[model samples]
Target: MSSTAEPAPAADPPSAPAPAPGRPSAPGFGQDRLWTVDEHLADILAAVHPLDPIELQLPDAQGCLLVEDVTVPAALPPFDNSSMDGYAVRTADVAGATEEFPAVLTVVGDVAAGSGSLPEVGPGTTARIMTGAPLPPGAEAVVPVEWTDGGTGGGAATAMSPAGPGDRGAGGEVRIHRPVEARAHVRARGSDVRAGDLALAAGTVLGPPQIGLLAAIGRGRVRVRPRPRVVVISTGSELVQPGEPLGAGQIYDSNSFALTAAARDAGAIAYRVGAVTDDADTLRSTIEDQLIRADLIVTTGGVSVGAYDVVKEALSSVGDEDEAGAGIDFRKLAMQPGRPQGFGSIGPEHIPLLALPGNPVSCYVSFELFVRPAIRALMGLKDIHRPVVRATLAADRTLSSPAGRRQFLRGAYDAEAGTVTPVGGAGSHLVAALAHADALIVVPEESSEVGPGTEVEVVLIG
Candidate 1:
């Protein structure tokens, strides 16, 4: 009778789990925050600022974007030069010259490259000139060595003899077998670029050819966004060095090496901190040591919810201990193989840090999706992402993925066939498969399965 009277008691609502350190807890129950790929990319980009411009040598500035319009300081070539190693002559003298009845001219002298002495070509006279040699005065055109009778009245020759060509006897008298127009085989002063002309605009990427142009304009150094000094570290107690003998349950440390190389490929000056054991104080100390040298910091293996995730434990408190805004915010992204990520700034300098997953393949995928773009952005590059192409799936069977996760599978892309074939199964531990892959096949969050012949977006790594 008493139990029946007390049967109408009220119950309380279930509570949501508390958020992790440095992460803002969701407001409601059963609601976990999940970031889209674009959301995560935007957050990363917002944290990065382009490096300050510095004057670097031409070779050092290669692959870096120019921060200012590089005007031609001096006219390219600086003076008119001969484009061929032959005779510099007036067009009028060789107007009707031919092999049968060639125009004979007296050799005034030879003009080699970098020759300071000048030679005057009077009427009925020519100057034997080398390629890149400044054109002698009073010469209106040039006759290539091949067009003449080798200056020896013999058969055709492949090249003109180099150095003191005047001593070769052929330089004494040259037969003008072919007529040349005005300025023929002669590069005019500033023909390539004139003084005050814009040789390269601001934001131009300096490659081999661009560097050559700058050198031609007499620019030994240029102002450009400097390459980011990235520091990469790995943390795992069960990880062993590659050459060391492994104990039971030990795996070789690969994230450090892979991430360092990837950072370099992204145009950052990467410094490998190797692997640290599962110790929060050690990780904290190591990061402190690297703060002075790092423009960006990358850590692998410690941003998860596990009890022993030292990176999360160490860096979560950095904001409070050091200066303001010095902590990392760990995120759970709606993506496969690289869902757990941590990004933030640390120390007095507020250096950006990206903490990725522990799995070898997962780390690499994270690097391509986030680290690469961050590095390029730091170098003031306009295009940060890898080239994406639409390709047809080339699998024999349909490929399945997690329903709500955006999956990135390793693939071998056939550029000619315009198809992409998955390299391995959906396993994050397959390092070998990732190595064999040259592309990443992206499956959308809403698409759980993709069949052969289906069009997909592929990120070309090659």
Candidate 2:
């Protein structure tokens, strides 16, 4: 639970080698050597640290983690209050009262909620109390309006008459028809929370119920770790904005929008920069311009070894002059769909950056594996990884995966049946299949083929 705001320096993965000057290192660049998914994730997580704490109003602090334990200032209820709108009477007066013969008492003035003064209930008197109104002095129990005549002198009254000038039972006699016990129907002081009690512990996320509790404990503002500001950039030459007419060899840009939304879902304040064409200088300048507001930078498209990979070409040399170990490391991972990946720090502040592949499915998978956890770590969340469960593979035939490489296939999981069915073919560009998938079926690198009915690990992403 350290509150230090400064991020810890990123360490190079054991499998990754140092980059050559003016270019990022791609370990085993021309060979078969590659980093595992776990290795790449560890490096990214090692570099991220929780953001600094800041004081924010209750409404603005929703979903933020509390930086310190908050204690209750006063007892919840603060005083004895009524839980029903009925007569507040002494138990002795209402004891053994029934429909055959009821205990009659004169009603005093109404005791509405927030009333400063309270009327005393003596041996033969009762006070009409509203729900949440403080229990008046000398009143031992409350009779719900449904259990009494409600001052109408009628049998089995349903509700208490109004207390204004047109009301007939404001100061009239009320007949109690039920026996009562002391303190019944009364919310005792400190019943919910007592003074000085820990209302919320440190590292608690402030949701609606937690916010209500904080407000009940009189906490108008609290200290919490602010969400990280994430800047999402997509780079490609043939990318066009959605809603615009597509020219030949051009496709709509979706990576930046998807990643931006995904970042927000991970509890980061995300900004989506429009797609930057395949130009090294433009991409580099765009990333530089966004550094002012970015705590983490995520770029889709251009980490592959292709000639048109502008992201790799532009960011390979970034932050190299600022400090040693300050540039991105582009490398291949021993995984399907998302193989080409890059991670490192950039800018004077050394903000963390993740470079993902260009394919739609590859880009999103990389985000879930790397960027999502980074954002959660920055937000000070304890459980940063997605939930994983074991499920039987629901397929008609055996599935194949490349030897020595782990494969993650989009899937539709049925929790009730404890089975997962693959959504579509294992193509990195299958955005339609990715959209329908609620889970990722994990095929281990050691297993080249998996048969139907085999139990496999599934990562729940829905």
Could you tally the backbone clashes for each prediction? 0, 0
Worst lDDT run of 10 residues, candidate 1, spans 1-10
The per-model lDDT (C-alpha) reads: 0.81, 0.83
lDDT, residue 351, model 2: 82
Indicate which candidate wins on TM-score. 2
| Tens-place lDDT digits, model 1, residues 140-169 | 988998888756444454436544544523
Q: Pick the candidate with the highest lDDT.
A: 2
Model 2 misplaced stretches (Cα beyond 4 Å)? 1-32, 152-170, 317-320
Task: Identify the runs in model 1 with alpha carbons over 4 angstroms from their true place.
Answer: 1-32, 152-171, 318-322
TM-score between model 2 and native: 0.90
| Model 2 alpha-carbon miss at residue 399, Å | 0.8
Q: Which pairs in model 1 have colliding backbones?
A: none
For each candidate, what TM-score against the reference? 0.88, 0.90
- Model 2 C-alpha lDDT per residue in residues 85-163, reported as the tens digit of each score: 8889999998899989999899876787877778888999999888999999999988998877767454454445436
